[model samples]
Target: MVRKYSKNDEGVSAVIGVILMVAITVILAAVIAAFVFSMSNGVSKPYTVGITIKKTTSGAVSIVNSGGPDVGQLEHVYVTYQPVNGAAINAYNGEVPADGPDTDTLFDYIEKFDALKTVGGSFTIPAEGVGSPNKVPPTTPTHVIVTGYFKDGKQQVIGEADV
Candidate 1:
């Protein structure tokens, strides 16, 4: 004798299992895509940084402001330095405070005038070390790095070799 098949509760379980699997798969795929997108855009962007330092009798260091100042604006602006044997050191930093000053001045004092106004368009301090008054060599006690953040929401790394 052959057993009779019914659509009562047998094959229904299989169908339900398949449906659950498909739903779970779809949810996982969406989560993965969102994670990847976040990681990609969260770390890459354009920015500008400025560095100012007192010029040695030899090396000529200048700080300039390249391209910045947007609506999103650099929410935060700061600087850090890499020591001769340690990690980067936080040197100087300033902020525009959204509804604050137009120009965020950093390390602006070192000589007869504030270098951040005149030679700060380039956002870099030219150096070759010390002992020439024009080139900063590779043997100085003081060195610095300047980083900039733009309203676009990106971090920029700029440095002014030995100071």
Candidate 2:
């Protein structure tokens, strides 16, 4: 006797194919949802401002705002001077030592920068004894750092140079 095979198994295969397709669609939707939700967190970006620092022949350090999109957002700028042989001196709001006439002059420049946050703004910290006391010596290289405070309560080191 010869046996005959029929197409009764077709229904079973169709059912499995449908289940597999549904599973794949669910997994794809989940992946996409996770990606979409993860990017909605609010995070502020840092300000981008151009700054230039240089040491002049007179042994003074000059800081200039080269102008950038974020320059208008600057609220104040602070300068920190680190000499090769002494403790770091910060010139902000009259923080420099008052023992010398030069320090008083340096403080004045810092104050002016803080007041005027304009493009192409520049200030010079005079060499030691000239107007800045020994904090910035002429013979020794000093590290000058300029930090900008933004109106959004963010502070960043805008520029640094060895002068």
Candidate 3:
């Protein structure tokens, strides 16, 4: 009688397969968790607000909140005035509200709170803000650029109007 040698390798492959499946599942779960957490902590939707720029006969520029979504706690507003025939004037900063409103005032307050406006809010650009020491003659052919900054460091070009 001859003695034969047998190799018992049946369980080796099954063990490796199970381990690989478990590792893949763990990795997938980790990826999904990271995505969910990031989404939950990300920035929310941006506030919508409309602005209008106009020039008064007195040569002062006006920024009006025509209508739009309420932007809570504005940080600042910047205005750029470009006269049709003259150089552009920059570096005018807008004022923020002293406090946040309890209810929606987006369209209620007009110009009383500097650049921060409720709907229908209107702000007049002072002569000094426009880089003029004295009364500057109002120019019809001018472009008024208005920008609004929120507390979140996000800014929007509220409006650009030619007057």
lDDT of each: 0.44, 0.70, 0.61
How many angstroms is residue 19 displaced in model 3 relative to the true structure, after the best TM-score fit?
35
Whole-model lDDT, model 1? 0.44
Q: What are the per-residue Cα lDDT tens digits for candidate 2 across 16-88?
A: 9999999999999999999998887766687888888888888777788888889889987877776778555
- Which pairs clash (backbone N, Cα, C closer than 3 Å) in model 3? 106-118, 106-119, 107-119, 110-121, 110-122, 111-122
Q: Which candidate would rank higher by lDDT, 1 or 3? A: 3
Count clashes in each candidate, considering only residues at least 3 apart in sequence or on different chains: 18, 1, 6
* Alpha-carbon lDDT of model 3: 0.61
Worst 10 residues of 2 by lDDT: 129-138
Q: List residue ranges in candidate 2 displaced over 4 A.
A: 4-43, 92-110, 129-139
Stretches of model 1 off by over 4 angstroms after superposition:
1-16, 28-57, 68-142, 147-163
The deviation in Å at residue 73 for candidate 3 is: 4.9
Error of 1 at 71 (Å): 11
Among all windows of ten consecutive residues in candidate 1, which has the lowest summed lDDT? 109-118
